[model samples]
Target: MRPFKSVPKARRGDRVAVISPAFAAPAISPAIHEQALRRLSESTGLIPVEYPTTRQLGASAEARAADIEAAFADPGIRAVMATIGGDDQVTVIPHIDPSIIAANPKPFLGYSDNTNLHNLLWNLGVPSFYGGSTQIHLGAGPGVDDIHLRSLRAALLEGGSIELTQTSESEDFGIPWEDPRALTSFGNREATEAWEWAGPRKAVTARTWGGCIEVIDEIAMAGRMPPLADLEGVILLLESSEELPSALAVKRWLRSLGERGLLQAAAGVLVARPPVSELSAPVPSAGERAALRHEQRDAILGQMALYNPQAVVCVGVPFGHTRPQWIIPHGGSITLDGTSRTVIADYAG
Candidate 1:
């Protein structure tokens, strides 16, 4: 693999491509995507450029791959953003020409199913951000979450230490995106707990890896990852999407990580604030839903104990499937301080 190199940051006047490499939710939610584009300009001072298939519904995998190539090949586009996430992105990865991507390294940002793209960049030894889907974060109508904006600037503009802080409040459920009002608000906000850190009391900094745990399962199952030794010293960043997989499912996936030697290979682990609810999926009873997050946290700890007891682990960082998310660098440096239970991300380097 080529050595890891930082993709140039998007400057104020620079143009950024908005591509739907995964699902074409943009076509379904054009109003919301418009708001996303508006916010991209107002919040970042960068222009949002669109590709032919960015808003096309059921675009062929080849078309999506072409948009990706164009985004990177064009020097005018300093960054690429996904409109939203979908489930079938795994199919699109095969169509991507990594050589084209490696030659034109630029910051690419998304989460959820977009993990496919993030992984592609990581394997190519290019640094890309792990969060900041335009629809989810930029189109945040109440305005972007300050925590997310702060991290976005650090990664794409300012480039410095963006400390990870528990979002004081968060919402995992939202009104349907079809309604224009969904573009106006994230529905409701509720208080959240501070991060829960377990494992040894020590600090370690390494390039971060992993995203959207469920998608990672796909990556692992597809054998898309490099050798276990290549992952040594990486800090694993895991999160669940709006699908809200059960604790059993999460444990099952973690069990695979252990089997594949990922559990012990990483220097440390950071889990995002679990999305306790998934709007598009079946809703559990109120009592059951409330307990899901606790189960997920314990499941991870239990798996770690059985697999990699020494792995420093922290849960509840706001990076995925949650409003006010941090745009984490996919292969960038982050410090996990066990004593403080704080994560300081170094995006500049």
Candidate 2:
């Protein structure tokens, strides 16, 4: 596999493309989407540029891919961001030309189903961010989470290393976008527990890979996954989405990756705090939610123990499908120190 390279950061006042490669979330709630755009511009100083398919609901895969191509092809567009993640982005991957992104490499920020695009960029030897959804993080919330904004700046405007920290509070799902209070209020938040660490008490530093495990499954089935040899010595970032897969499901997914030698190839693994509830479903009780997280953590640890007990592992650092997210790198550097249990991410790539 080709080594990934860092993309140039955008300066204040530079233009950034806000494309909807997965779902046209903006079309569902234009009010929140517009507010997110304003907040993005205000918080980062980069102009938000939108493409035709950015807000077009039910856009064709080819059209979405073209918007992505145009965003990268334009030298003026310093970064590309997704509005929000949705199902079926896997179908859009075939339409994107890897060369276009490789030729004009730049920061691409997103998570969840956007993992498909991240994997595409990973294979093309380009680094991208693994979190940040304009509709989810910027628009629906009362304000941007502090850690999120800091990491966003690091990924786009500032080139620096930051030690990941807990926000003490987290939310599985926020209010519905249609609710007027969604813009001015936060969701039902609760205190969080400390991250759980396992494996050898050693530090592992390498360029990061992996994303939503569900998406990784799709990429693997599509035969788009990089060789296990390429993943050697890398820190794997694994997390689940709002679908709230059961612990058994997560175990099956990780076991599949392990069977494929992905687990054994990694130097370390960092699993995000998985979401336990969703807006469409009744909120689980506090104990039930904690139990869910624990079950998933144990499942991951069990699989890792069977596959690569030597690799350092940490679970429950908020990054994917959760609030107060830290937009860590996709194909960039991350240091997992098991002895000290610290996760320091280098946004400089």
lDDT of 1 by residue, 271-341 (tens): 98888866766766667655888899999989998988788899888888888788887888889999877
- State each model's CA lDDT, in order: 0.84, 0.94
Positional deviation of residue 159's Cα in model 2 after best superposition, in angstroms? 1.3
In order of appearance, the predictions have TM-scores of 0.96, 0.99
Top model number, TM-score: 2
Give the top-scoring candidate (lDDT).
Answer: 2
lDDT of 1 at 212: 90
Root mean square deviation (Cα) for candidate 1: 1.6
Residue 247, model 1: Cα distance from true site in angstroms: 0.7
lDDT (0-100) at residue 245 of candidate 2? Answer: 93
Model 1 spans > 4 angstroms off: 280-287
